[model samples]
Target: MSGTAEDATDATTKRQRRGNTRQRIQDVALELFAEQGYEKTSLREIAERLDVTKAALYYHFKTKEDILVGLSQDLQRPIDELIEWAGTQPRTLDTKREILRRYSVALADVAPLFRFMQENQAAVRELSVGESFKDRMIRLIDTIKEPDAALTDQVRCTSALFTMHAGMFALRDVEGDPEEKRQAVLEVAIDLVTQAHAGAQSPGKPPKSS
Candidate 1:
């Protein structure tokens, strides 16, 4: 019994090591892709950067596009899960706020992927990045916007989503901490969703004074 248990532990450790190696390969590949254009990066260069043989890299990922697709999937999975979770929740102000808060957290760690996607627009479009993102945005918007909302209220909901997306790139040159800017952007997005929700709930009614 002890031998069996020891073998299982060894297998688990080996699996974890393999997973870490795969992740490292993906990270280095993305870094190289960002430094140079994706079109200019090659599998040999990636292996060189990692100090690994091409055969070793091939044992994990078969191609450069495969690495990219893996990275894209990793980035998309959280938002996909968030959209699924939001779909099952009651569409209330609190839910919208929570969605925005959760989204802000999701976007926070995705800066590298975001920068890579922006620089390699054509490559991103060719992968699952483009449509997957659009679908998630649509799901988020539908969750936040009321079925009977007026045009302006709908715009507010849409704009709130776009604001988070823009904040990542727009404030890159501004003179403030990244976290501070993220908080400011999240506050603005939450405000937009809150106002849109209130407007939809009470049509033609002016906002209550603070």
Candidate 2:
């Protein structure tokens, strides 16, 4: 193999190793957070759980909140990418539908984190979880909502996003397969956006002229 090819392979391997370690830290930290409360879980405890020294744990995450924030940011990256991609596309029904589709898939992987946030609302609030998630939602709404959309149509767009977010935890008590529930939620969310888009394109009430 060429020297450049070898270097590329080596870089890929190193990145994979780093990703694996980071995910391991997140997994161990989340486990500790659940077993005990996030407030009770310490950096030392996380280090002990991972069988690593505090210094090693600190290398990846400095505090419990940092670990939580890191996990949140890791989950946010794909959604951010989706928003960026959607922004470039023409604001059409097809583009909006694809956006909802991708967003649903992205949220599916964060079910555990979503539960953690729900169970530890105080801790999550302190970390500004709502602000970060809300900011992303606003960006996504902008991508779907037309400039002259009616108030009700805008509500539909916002509701569609919230439905997907809430589906992760809200549907937990409903007895059925997990993936099936997710599909059902996705269908509802898509239907919402589809209805909103159709309404926006349709001619509504004309202005009242004197």
Candidate 3:
């Protein structure tokens, strides 16, 4: 019984250790890719920086592209899940507003992935991550905008997301705390959603929101 218990403990420890090593590899790889440019960074360099043998690193990721794909896949998983969940819900303004709120939270950590994506557009394209990215954006917009939404209102919803994305990079130079800027951006986005929702509901009503 003691032998069995000891073996289980050792297995658990090994699993935990492996998980930590994988996360560390991801961190170091991203840092290096940012510092040295993805095209120039090699798996050997990554293994060297992590002080691990190339074969050990290869056991986790066979190539630099594999590491990048892993990073993007990790970052995009939540968004893909959110989009899938939203697809099953009834179409309503409330649902759309909630989607925006949830999406804001989902995107909080994705800022870095976006940074890598913008800098490595060609790699992302080559890897075909952009296909799912575009598809998810369409689904998200469908959740928010009315199917019969007027072009202007559609523009508002589209612009709302663009503004939120722009805020991530554009407001980097702005004064005040990052949280404050995030709230301000959220407020603006929520206002856009509210306006679009109102316009869709009110046939002859004045502007729903600006």
Candidate 4:
């Protein structure tokens, strides 16, 4: 029994070590993809950066696209959870605000991935992850916007989502604390959603006389 227990512990340790190595590969690959364009980066370059043999890297990931897909899967998990949670909640102003706040947090967590996506737009679009992300955004927008909202109000709700994204990239070079910038961006997004919600709640005004 003791020998069996020891073998189980050893197996667990090996799995943990493998998980760490896979994560290291993913991190190094993302950095390389960001430094040079994704197309310019090679699996050998990623292995060289990690001081690992190509075979070792291959054990975790077979190609550059596999690395990217893995990264996207990790990043998408939180957003997927958020979308699922939002679907079960009441579509009130408070719920919308909370969604933006949570999304802001999610964005901050994946800032590096976002930066890579921004710099590699064409590559991202060509990948399946890009389409998956777009569908997720549409679901999120539905949670915040009224189905019958006016065109302008709908724009406001949609803009709220983009505002958070744009803020991350726009403020990259600006001087300030990272958390502070995130809060500021969240504030703007909340304001836009609030405005759209208010407009939806109010009755339409009569046309003015000529």
Most accurate candidate by lDDT: 4
Candidate 2 lDDT, tens digit per residue, 86-166? 978999999998998888888877778777777787777667655797788788899988878877778889999888878
Q: After superposition, how far is residue 58 of candidate 4 from its true place, in Å?
A: 1.3
- The sequence of per-residue lDDT tens digits that candidate 1 reaches over residues 6-35 is 999999999999999999999999899999
Query: Predicted candidate 3: what Cα RMSD to the true structure?
Result: 2.6
List the candidates' TM-scores in order: 0.89, 0.82, 0.85, 0.94
- Mark the regions of model 4 whose C-alpha exceeds 4 Å error after superposition: 206-210
Q: How far is candidate 2 from the true structure (C-alpha RMSD, Å)?
A: 4.5
- Each model's lDDT comes to 0.87, 0.83, 0.79, 0.89
Residue 199 displacement in candidate 4 (angstroms)? 1.6
Q: Rank the candidates by TM-score, best first.
A: 4, 1, 3, 2
Instruction: Give the count of colliding residue pairs in each prediction.
Output: 0, 0, 0, 0
For residues 1-210, what per-residue lDDT tens digits would candidate 3 score against the true structure? 999999999999999998898888988999888776788889889999999999999888888777887787765787778778888888776777777777777667767766666677676676656666777777677778888777778888987777777777778678989778877887788788778888888757656442
Candidate 3 wrong stretches, greater than 4 Å: 85-90, 203-210
Worst 10 residues of 1 by lDDT: 124-133
Badly placed stretches (over 4 Å) of model 1 are: 204-210
The residue ranges of model 2 lying beyond 4 angstroms of the native Cα positions read 1-19, 128-130, 206-210
State the lDDT of candidate 4 residue by residue for 59-177, as single tens digits.
98998888888998876898888889998999899999999999899889999999898888898888888888888889889989999887778998999999999999999999999
Q: Name the Cα RMSD for model 1.
A: 2.7
Q: What's model 2's lDDT at 5? A: 100
Q: What TM-score would candidate 1 get against the native?
A: 0.89
